[model samples]
Structures are given as C-alpha cells and as structure tokens.
Target: MASLNKHSIGGNIFLLLLAAIFMLMGVYFQWLYTNESNAALAEEIAYQKAQEEYHDSNIYYEPEASIRWLLLRQHPAGYFVPNPDLLFEPTQLNDNTLRATRYAISILYELGALDSINPKTIIEYVMENYLADIQSAGEVDGAVYHNGPYAGFGTLSSRPAAVRPTMDALLILNLLGGLDDPRLDLDRVNKFILAHMNDDGGFWDEHYAQSGRNSSLRCTSFALRALSIIQGHQKKGFSTSDRERITSFVVSTHDPASGGYADFPGREATDSYFVFRAFISIWSLASGDLAERREYVENHMEVDHTIDYLFGQHYLKDEGAFSRYYRDLQSVSSLKATNLIIWFMTSMGRMEVLPEKAILQYMMSKQNRPGEFGGDMYTTYSALSTFSRLAVSTEPMSQPKKPTRHASIPAYFPLMLFSLSLLTLITSYFTKKHEMEARNHILARQASIDGLTGILNRNGFEEGLEKQIGQAIRHDKPLALIMMDVDNFKDINDRHGHIVGDKILKEITRLMTENIRVYDIFARWGGEEFMILVTEAGQDKAVQFAEKLRKIIESGFFGIESKVTCSFGVAMYRKSETIDEFVHRADEAMYNAKHSGRNQVSTVPTSAKKDDRVVEFKP
Candidate 1:
C-alpha cells in the first residue's frame, strides 16, 4: 500500500510539469508571431509618415509679409538704404545703393507693387544722378555708365565707372523699358562694353585703365549680363565666337571635384557669389544654346551637394538662418548664403521643398520691424528677391492642412508582450534570429540597388568605379569611362507624371543593361544620369560604344510621344589623373555633346591630342 501511494504522487507531479511545458510553448509561439507583426507594422507606419511629410501639399506662402519687409527698407530718396533708420542722418551710399534700388524695383514690378509706387520718379532720379557719359570723361570710345554714388556733391570727378554699378543701372533701365531713353545711348554703351573686353575674353572692372587689374569673374559676369540685356533691346550683341570664348573662360573657373566655381583661375575656394555670377555669365553668353547652358549648369553646379554642405556647415537650423561660416551663429545672418539657397531652389524648380515659413520668419527677424532697415543694402536686396521668388512660386498645395494618424497603439507596446513571452519556448529564439537575418539581407540588397530603377545606386556605382580604377592602375591597362544623361529629362517629368517618368527610367535601364557587354559595369549616376565603366577599352572603343548607346536610346520607345535621346561623354583613363579628374573629363565631354546637340557622343582626347579635346561624334 505504501509503494502504491509513492508511485501515484510521482506520476501526478510529472503530469503537471508536462502540462506547464506545453502551455509555455504555446505562449512563446504566440509572442513571437505578435512581435514580428508589430515590428513590420511599425516600419510601415514610419515609412508612411515620412512619405506624407515629404509630399505634404498643405504648405502655404504669404507674399505680402515678404513684400512688407522689403517696403520697410525703402527710403523717400527713391533709393533703398542699408538701414532705413539712418534716412534722417547723413548716410554714406555707394554701389550698393544702385544694386538695392534695382533689386527693389525689380521685385516691386514682379509683385505688381508698381501699381501703388510711382516708378517714374525713381527712374528719373537714377538716370539723372547715376548715368555718366564715358566719352565725356575720355575713358572709352563710347558708352554711358553709372558713375556710382559719391559721398558728397560735385565729387563726380572722383567717382570711377564700375562694371557692377553700370550693369545694375543698365539692367534696371532695361527692366523699366527705358532702353529707348534719350539720355541712355545704347550704341555708346555697347561700344564701351566691347572696348573693355580683354584679350582673354573676359571684361575688366573699370576699362582696364582705372583699376589696372586682371579680368575678374564678377566684372565679366556683370559686363556679359549687361551686354546680353542690351542685345535684347537692340539686334546687335557679341558675336557667337566671342560668346563661345567667354563661355570657355567661365567654364575654366569651375572646380570639377567640388562642382563649384572659383572667383578666378588658380583660386580653388568657391563662394556662392562667384558660382552665381559664373552661371549668369554663361547663361547670358549662351542665349542660343539655352538647353545646353542649363545642362552645363546642372552637370557642373553641384547645387544640391553644395546646399547640403552649406546647411550642414553654416546653416543654423534652429534659428532658420545661415551663418557666414561653419558654427558661427553669432555672426550677422548671411544674406549671401540665404539668397543663394533661394535662387538655387527657384532655378531648380524645387520651391516646394523649401522651408517657406521658417525662411520667412528668419527674414522678418533680420529686418527692423517698425522703422529701421533690417540689414545692409545687399542683405535687404537679397531678402526682397528671395521673398518675391517664394511669393510667386507655382507649386501646388495639399488640400488638408494636417496629417492623419492611423496607428492607435504605441510603438513599444509589442516590447512589453515580448518580455512576457520570452520565458516560454525554445523555438522562439530561432524564429526571432531568422527574422533579423532576413531583415538585414533585405537592407543590404536595398542599399546596392536604386529603389526607382532596380539598378546599381550612386553608392554602388562609386564603389565599382574605385575597384575598376585600382585594377586599371595595377595592370596599366587602358580603361574608358562613359557618362550619359537623358536629354530634357526634366521636360519629360513635367509633361508626364512622376509615375510615367519612373517607368521610362526603368525601361531605359533595361535597354541599357541588355545592350552593354556583361563585363561592362553600368550604374545610374543620378537623376537621368548614367555611367559606364568599360575595361580594356581605348578612346576609340569608348567613343564607338557611346555612339552605339546614343543610337539605341534615340530609337527606343519610351512610352511618350517624343523620342528619347541621351548625350554621352567618353574619356580614356590617363596615367596620372585621379578617378575624379578622369570622371570630370568624361563629364565635360558629355557636356560638350549636349552643347553641340543632343543624341551625340563626344570624347576627351588622349595624351597626343590633349590640346584638341572634346571631339564630337554625330550620327
């Protein structure tokens, strides 16, 4: 009887333990499934939120606020002062007076403020006080120019003709339809500008006699823009060849590695002003090749990268203003950087991406609210221009002003459940591990492939280029790099929605992959830009391949009414050049192809013909 009793107890305990184990296993599996589902849901929610923010359409811009800020800077003297509070005092004015006045007038005209303001009085004041006859001064053959403002009266003899002031005055006059003014002699102004053109195809600041300095980018930009405006009023302008030479000079100022323009040759440091001026100069000269000029700017300007750098290094995000340099928030707000950003956004047609409210608030903060000018003349001018641009932007707005939230549970609620289930089953460990591994694999794959086209991304392309460059250098084998961009891709995107545009890119990628050799490494460089690395190929082979690709693209059906075309640039790897320089040469060639005409191949010449670079191949 005692033996029976002991056995019964042992069996009961064993049964209980078995039951407990089974219950725990069930709990573990349930927790694992729930955790995985919750994680996926969280990821999806985050992605949706980000997408909503990125494409938010409820943003609104008030132009009146900006216009009010600009109007506060105006003085009763028919000119804009750096500080309106100083209007009652004897304020010293210089070239900026002319520039500010022009900017203010231009913005007012653009915003329909001219209806309220009497522009005739201002125009007359500027014409009578600023315009000077160069022939009378015996400074040049013919031309009337702005003498720039003087500190005291009867100091006209002391004031010299500067390219910037003259350009500003001329642009203002042109804007006001005052080109036909009896006091303004267009023929004389044209001759004066022509005489200032240096042998190097740039212009001097002050007729080369007053300043006696080398041709500067700033002066050249102003002079070229003025001449371009003059040409619009009259039929005559700089000859095409002369304009081409001027374009070459502007191109030479570009730093390929940085995608920024230097102030002059041998000066590699880039400033926003210099880059802006260089772009304007090229644009003015390349009037006939407008598309090519835009392409050139797009390829060389690196606007997006530069903006990132400026924002990272100099922009005070919290304050919503840019500083002059990195980490110098206390310094006066950098109107130059701020204005550059605005211009860049406008030119790139990316106004929708700007932080409109923040920028507006920052500008308002900089201005004297009640009775004073907010900043210097240029600062006010830049602020006015930036505001005007923001006010006139045509970007669509979202219907609803606020984003809708879909999730009710906290993101961490799954964690609490996970803790409770952790003590349950052994199989749950393996399941979680497997899920993590799968997620990592997906991430790695995504990093290598572009989301839009399923091709190698920019990071992947750069990695491939580095590896190929190392191989080419080690073996001393000839390698060629090819750069190509879809001609007028922006136009396509504008005409068709982004969905169709994306489809076109995917189709183009498929076609490229099918046509290129298996050994050739190809990747999407950026939006509508693709690059190919061809091993064991000389310049001739590269050019031939580029031409072949161009033809294929031109003939391919892109699901649009118009035929798709691409411009290609080819360059053979040089013995001493770095990878960036090599790529830049190819880019330059591509730019030349676009400049020459779309659907063509251009090659950078090898060592023997380095002087005769950028040879174009047309089909």
Candidate 2:
C-alpha cells in the first residue's frame, strides 16, 4: 500500500510540469505573431508616404541634375562663374567673381554638400579676397579705391563693402560653420551693418544702388539678415516703434495692382526681386512661431492678394518660368525671377499652387550638358533650391499651424486671374508697339555679342574701340591696344578638335575679364585672338599689363588635358591715327611675339622713332 501511494505522487508532479511548459510555448508564439503584424503595418505606412511624396503633382524635383550643373561651374578655390561656356577654360583659383560663389556655396550648404568641397581653401579665399582685401577679388590690389570704406565684403575688395555683398558673405560664413573662426569680427561686422540702417527704418547701400533713393527693400533685407546673424536669434533688438515704423515703411512699397512689393516707395515697378527682399525683411522683423509671422503679415497687408498676384500674375503657367516684370512674354522668363518667386511661395506656405512640372521642364531646358544646368551659380542655386523645395513635406513641423491659410486660397483664385487678364488688355490699349520696341532693343544689343564667349564680337569691339578712343581723346588720356592670339591654336583645333580650341579662347576671355580694369574695353577679335584697349595707360604700363596677362594665362586653369600658351602684341595709339593703322601696328607686334617664340609680349616702337622696331618683353 505504501509503494502504490509514492508512485501516484510522482505521476502528479510530472503532469504539472508538462502543463507549465505548454503554457510558455503559447505565449512565445503569440508575441511572434503580434510583432510580425506591427512591422508589416509600419512598412505599409512608409510606402504610402513615399508614394504621396513622389506623386504626379510634385514630380519636377531634379536635385541630381541641378547639382551636376552647379558642380560643373565651381572654381578650384571655391568661387563660381556665371557662364558655363567658360567651364573648360584655364582659370586661376580665386579667379571667378564672389557673386556666384556666394549663391553657390549657400546652395551647396543647404543641400548638405560640404563633404564634396575643401572648406579650408574657401575660407582662406574669403578671408584674403573679401574680408581682408589681400587679393581684391582677382584684381591688382587696392590701387583703385584705396580709401575704401567698411571692409566687410564687395565684388572688388578695393571698393567699399556694400550692404548686399556684406550680408551675403556673412550668410555664407554662417552656412559654412565659420562662427568658430577667429578672423571673423562679429562686432565690426555689426557696426558696418548698423551704419547702413537709416531713420527711414530701412537699410541703404550707398555703394550698390545709386538710384537716388535713400533706402530700398533690397538693402533693408540684406541689412536685417546681417544684423540678425551678428546679434543672434534674439528679438529684443527691435523696439515697438521700430517695428511699427518698419512695418509702415515696407507696406508703403507694396503695389495693390500687382500684389507685389517694390524696392522703393512711390509705386516703383514691383518685381520678383523686390517682392522677395520685402518678404524676407518682413519675416526677419517678426519673431516667435511661424504662425505669428503670418499673423503679423496679415495684420499689415492683404496677404491673399500677394498670393494671387504670385500665382495668376508673375507665375506664367504656360512658360513654367516667372517674368521679371508683369505682362512680359514667356521668352523673357528668368531663372532669377522663378527662384525668387519660388522661395517666396515656399516660405509663405503655398507650394500647392505652383506649376511644379512646368518649372522643372524650364529649369532642365537651361542644362547645356548632362548634369549641367548651363547657367551661372545664381541659376544653379535657384534651380537646385526650387527642385529641393518642391519635394518639401507640408507636415505639421514643416508649415504654419493655421488652417485659414489654406482657406483663403480658394477665395482669391478667380478674382486674381480676372484682374490680371483685365490689366493685360488695358496695357495693350495704352502701349502701342511698346513691348515690341523693347524686345527689338534687346535683340539689337545681343547682335554684337560673341556667341562663343559672352564678350564683344569683332563688330561690337570696333564700336566699343571707337568709343574708347574718343573718350581717351576727350580726357587727354594715353591709350594702348594689346592684341593677343593663342599659340599653335590651329594645331590645337586640328589635333584636339575645334571644341577644345573654342574652350581655350573662352579661358583667355575669362582671364582678361578678371585682370583688366572694369572701364577698359575687351573683345573677341575673331578666332582665338582678342583685343584690349588700355585707357589712361601708356605703352610702358600697357606692355606690363600684357605681360601680367601672359603669365596669368601660362599658369591659369585648364579645363582640358592639354597645356596652352599665347603671344601678345601691344601698340600705343598714335594721335589721330586711323583705326586700321593702329590695329595693323598691334597685329604686327603680335606676329613678332610669335616669331620670337611663344608666350611673349612684343610692343611696336612709336612712328616718331628714327627706326620703327619691335621690342619684346620676356621673363
């Protein structure tokens, strides 16, 4: 009886162990099923969001193409050129203008492309050329404008740092994480910026705009941006009266007919640039949440009218580009105008109303090559920026919280379109053949432009040369003509093809543009040769200038695989000499350079000398 009882207890213990094991297995399987369900649900939501983002309406975003074009125009020293036709020419580092670099660097920074560039080289260039004025934007130092004022930034550091360029440089430095840089003086920069602000409650660029106006929306926006960056993100700097005065000043620049702001008051022509500057100043002045900015703007202006003006007026749906002025043709469409308008729209929370597909098409049309947007860094910035902004999500964090912002759109659409159409008809009645005349004037000027290099063609050069000669005669200035021709250029074309030769000429033109004085005349004298009229400079100075150019070309940038050289010929313009005689002397001197080996500057002795001889300047 004791053995039977012990066996029963063992059997009971085994049954309890089996039951616990089965319960554990059930819980494990249930957890596995739940987790699988959750992961599948998450993946499905992600796919839906992606599909929404890449839908038909928002398909114009081509970041890859925009980046390709921008990179193509980038100089080695981190500057940028406006023309891509000069892409393959030999240009020096720090050779291109700061204008394009300012925009290009800003765009690249926005796109998070810092890893692609050497920031140190760029920083060094900026410090030396703009801020410190060591090199002076690829010019010959501060020989001119020696008494330049407020040296924060400018095209040529020799000139006074204007409000626009100064603010642009500061923005670039900020984008480049240059705050830690010791060379940047926030205190000095703020002082320069503050100096531009007038009692009119607007910023004035004494150097940039000589338009006689004391202040403009453009300068005000630039000043405010620089001031904000220098002072940090605090709103305590502007007083209640200051804000009110500013609000009143900016509002006064607005045009009710076009629903855009002008650069100045008194109903100036309202365009994309002015409107953009006005909007930025308005945003910068307003603090707190994005909703507060919208509220502030609404309190001041008929914000819906601005929206309608942008959509049905400035934005040409048919062209996919914006006009610089209202009632302009689609052919007059500008990348700058489109960019500024898009920037404004994106900021105002109205991307849904844009013609995204058309804009993409127009932007891509400007591309000269694969990944090349075929415009300057300004256009590249606009194109790339526009493309990126197109895909921006209108999520809760990305946009304003007000639902009424969307509601106002439907009410303003029909009225805006009708007003635009009516205005166009009225303008046609008043201005008889006015638009045609304006277009013809542009075409006439473009006629003289060299298609190869944006410089003057032979015909254009002749007209300009005659004008300069007259100016020299009037000012009683000594003048010299320096003619330059590529060495072995025909061989380069024969061996490397005409395409390579064309690039060489373009490079030469780029160098001339950088080295020559702004007032000096430069032109393409046809083929691989160019002409320069050195005003107020005698034979000695002109010869030296030619030599400088010879060296620059010798070591300048080469976009191609082959090395290139040039021969220079200079001649002092004899008083009352025929243009042909003057040109012949310079041409003969150039051949003398070719005969005396390549890459030398040869000058023709004056006719007054007993023996007319060719004197060559060599290293």
Candidate 3:
C-alpha cells in the first residue's frame, strides 16, 4: 500500500510541471506575436505619412500666357526696349536699357522661348558696345568697364564707365556665357573689378574717385555679384577672409527697426532696390551665416510695411500699375520700381501673398499687342519678368503611390495549429513573428538607407538635396553640394574580396559623418561614390569643407592594412538653375577632380570655359 501511494504522488507532480511549461510557452509566443504586429503597423503608418508630406511639398505649376505676351516687346537690335509702343521707333540705350535687355533675355530663357529669339546676337551687341577699357589717372591700366551714363537720352552719347552698368554687364555676360567669349577679356574685367574694392572692403559707385571711399548697398551688391561670377569662372577672385569682409559690410546696412536694408549705414529710409541688392549680395557671396541672415530678414518681413506702401500708396487700382513712390501718382508708374518689387517679393518666397490677379491684369494692360508689353524698355522688361514669375496654374497636390499590402493570414490557421502540442504551436508562432519583424525592418531601412554603409542612399540624398534647394531659393540663401568618389574602389574590390571593400566603405562613412556638421547631409550616392549638401555655405566654405573631408579619408584606416583616398568635387547652387543642372555641375566637378589626379578637390566654374573643365583655384 505504501509503494502504490508514493508512485501516485510522483505521477501527479510530473503532470503539473508539464502543464506549467506549456502555459509559459504560450504566453511568451503571444507576447512576441503581439509586439511584432503592433510594430509593423506603426511603421507602415509612419512611412505613409512621410510619403504624403513629401508629395504635398512637391507641387508643380504651369506658367501663364502673359509671359509669352511680354516676349513680343523684343527690340530689333536683339535687346528689349522699355516700351512696346516704341517697337518701330529708334530708342536710346543706357544702363536701364541694358538691364531691361538682360531681364528680357532671362525671361525668354526661363520660358523656353529660345526658338523665337536669337539671344546670341543680343549678347554679342552688349559685349561689343558696353565693354570699355578704363585708363583714367587713378584707375588701374587696361581695366575693363561696362561704360554708361546710367540715365541718358540715347546711345548716341559717350558715357564714363560706371559701377552700375559695369556690374550689370558682368552679371549678364556671366549668365549668358559672354565671359567665355574671346572677344571679351575676362582677365581685364577681373582686374577692373579688383580695382573697385574700397578700403572698407565694400565697393564704390561711379563717383568713387570723388566720393571719398564711401560704399553704398547698391554698388556693393552689384560688385559682389560680379565678383562672385568671376570667382566661379576664375576660381581665384576672393579669399575666405575677403568674402567675410564683403558680407559684413552688406549686413551692416541692415535696418533692425524697419527690417529693410538701407543704401548706406547712416541712411534711415529703406528702398526696395537697396534691399534687393543687399539680399542678392549675401546670397551670392555667402559672406555670413545664411540661417542667421534669413532669420533677420524673416523677422523684419513679418511686420514689413513695404507691402502696404506698395499696394496701398503706389498701386494704380484702375491702371494696374505700381508707381515708384507713394507721394507721386501723376507720372506713369516706374517700371524699374515695379520690377524691383516683384523680384524682392519673389526672393522672399512671398509671391503667393501678393494679389497675383491684379498684378497680372496690370501687366497684361501694358501690352501693346499680342506677345508685347508696351512701355519704356525698363517698364516693359519689369512687366514681363513679373508676369513670367507670377503666371502659374496650381493643381491639386498628389500623394505618392502607397506600398503594396502584405499577404493576409488565414483566419482558421491559428485554430488548426492549436490541435498541435502547446510547445510546438508556440514555437511556430514565435518563429513566424520574428521573421516578419526582421523582414519589415529591412524593407523600411532599404528604402532610404544604404544597406552596407548604413547612411542615406541615393534616393534619400536626392530628396534631402531637393528640400535644401527649396529652402535656399525661398530664403535667398546660398547652398553648396559636394560629390566624392573613392579612388580605385574597383581595384580594391578585385584585390581584396568585396567584403573587405564594404568594410572600407563603412569605415569611410563613419569617418565622414564625424567630421561634417550636424546639419550637413552626407549620403551614399552609389557604390564607391558619396554626396553632401552643405546649407548656407558659399563656394569658398564648400571647398574648404571638401578639402577637410578628403584629408580625413586619406588619413583614416580600415580593419585591413590599406591606404584609401577620395576625390571631391564641389559646387554652389546658382540662382535660376534647375535641380538637375545643379547636381550635374557638382558631378562634373567631381569627375574633374578624379581625372585631374585623384584625391584632390575641384569646383565648378562660374562660367563654362572652352575646355569645359574648371581650373582649380589654388587659394
């Protein structure tokens, strides 16, 4: 009896232990399954939200018919006159006329109307007539100038070389590739520009000789733009410190109270022209911190009275034209002032806030005929540019196509699986759940990040670049892009297995990430190639940054014993250039760096040179 009782007790204890183990297994599997399912759903929701936001920010627009109407005002001389009313009449040309011509050309270029007009002829004429050799007593010998009596009756009169026209000519020539023409001496032009740098590091206007070294925002802005162009072309114009001085001078002109830039430090009144000039100068030169400058502008713009002054006081409600000043309404609205206002507003990315319909109506009213905006060349040009900028049709923003849904599980599967032992069912469920979670994580990561290096992939890099470009354009700030390629990467992969090559890449990425700023974007553009977008950095700063990156790579080591080096190409975004063009320039520069002997940094030339290769600026 004693033996039988002990046996029964042992059997009971074993059964209870088995049941407890099964229960524990079931609870663990349920927890794993629930956590993974919730995680996947959350990730999908977040990804969908991100996709929607991206699409919303990428809306496109079709330009209106008014831009085409303005093109008809082109002059027979291949330039545009201020008024379409003077189409058949001979017109006098001055700085305003030249500037109007530049604007017209830019508009036509933007509108893809090159088929209708011969820009080459217009460019040739400006280069031939406006290019002057200044040999004055105090000026440097053989200094080239864009000669003009800025306000004049006609082209018949000879005028002294002035800062405004010279700067305008330089900007136009740079934009139209006139600087590359052999007929125009870029060296002399460069010298002429260098001569204008004042003791205060700002530029002087036409009266520099008599003005006693005074600097005005207008002249300084023009000079900086021209210099920036030369720097792009020559890659040797201004030093980092020199650029800093120029930027400092421009920032000094800012009116903290009015949120407008003054002509000079002591001047209290703010004008649109001065403001535009100041903004462009900083944008082109990148002399100061861009984010800070943007903040200053934004703060002032928040309460800007210019909009009220422009629309309320100077606007011609019936005529749809804007006058130059609030006090004067008798004369025709100033075309120069109107154009400046449009450009300023556009630069601030505040175009949508203005009365687009009224502005367009006024622009159309100025047209004398189909494809012609009638007024003086300056006003006509202003109206055309304004129309081109504002004429766009908005459409509903579309979201990106959603990712395909995962396969649904069978409803009866869990019940059927329950027929198996508790431990077996729990093991199967946990295995499937773990697999699903790993697969989802990989899919999500692979979309925007490089699989090997764990950095941003090409798609991610492009998206980031697009966002940065938009911000730069909207705020009138500078942006720099860098492209780097690992030298002899193919050879490295061939000599040492691909696994080793990948290890090197991962190390390189880690090293670069540590060296760059927190905001700077570094991405794996492709196998053995990488890209970086440095916001608010000018060409000079970009070059320096690139050089730093190059050195870091050259000096670093991977787990294997090998010396690795990278070649870098840098480019600053140009105003009005498409994203493709901007990226192409950087890619070209990177190629130049690679071809010119790997492990060096090169920059895109401001103007296309004959060889299509940008000469390395040693400074």
- Candidate 3, residues 170-199, lDDT tens digits: the string is 666666767777666666665665566766
* Poorest 10 consecutive residues by lDDT, candidate 2: 399-408
Q: Write the per-residue lDDT of candidate 1 for residues 1-619, one digit (tens) a residue.
A: 7888888878766655664465455545556656766766677777677667655433333445546766766666566655556655544355456777787776666556666556676667567544345545554324323431111111122455555666777777777767777766666666656656777777776533454656677778878887888897886656878977777777777666555566676665335566667767866765445567667566545666555555555556787776553322344457667776677657656565466767766775676542112545456556666766777342445433333433454545444444444342333467568878999999988887888888898888888888888898999889989999998887788889888888888988998999999988988988999999999998778788888888888889988899889999888887788878888888888887776767898884233364545568887
Candidate 3, residue 614: lDDT: 55
What is the lDDT of every predicted structure here? Answer: 0.68, 0.70, 0.67
| TM-score of each prediction | 0.51, 0.48, 0.43
Instruction: Summarize candidate 2's per-residue lDDT along 421-507 as a digit string, tens digits.
Output: 434334433442675688799887787889999988888888988988888888888988999999878667878888877877888
> Model 3 off-target regions past 4 Å?
1-97, 130-133, 136-158, 207-213, 235-238, 287-323, 326-338, 365-368, 391-619
Query: By descending lDDT, how would the candidates be arranged?
Result: 2, 1, 3
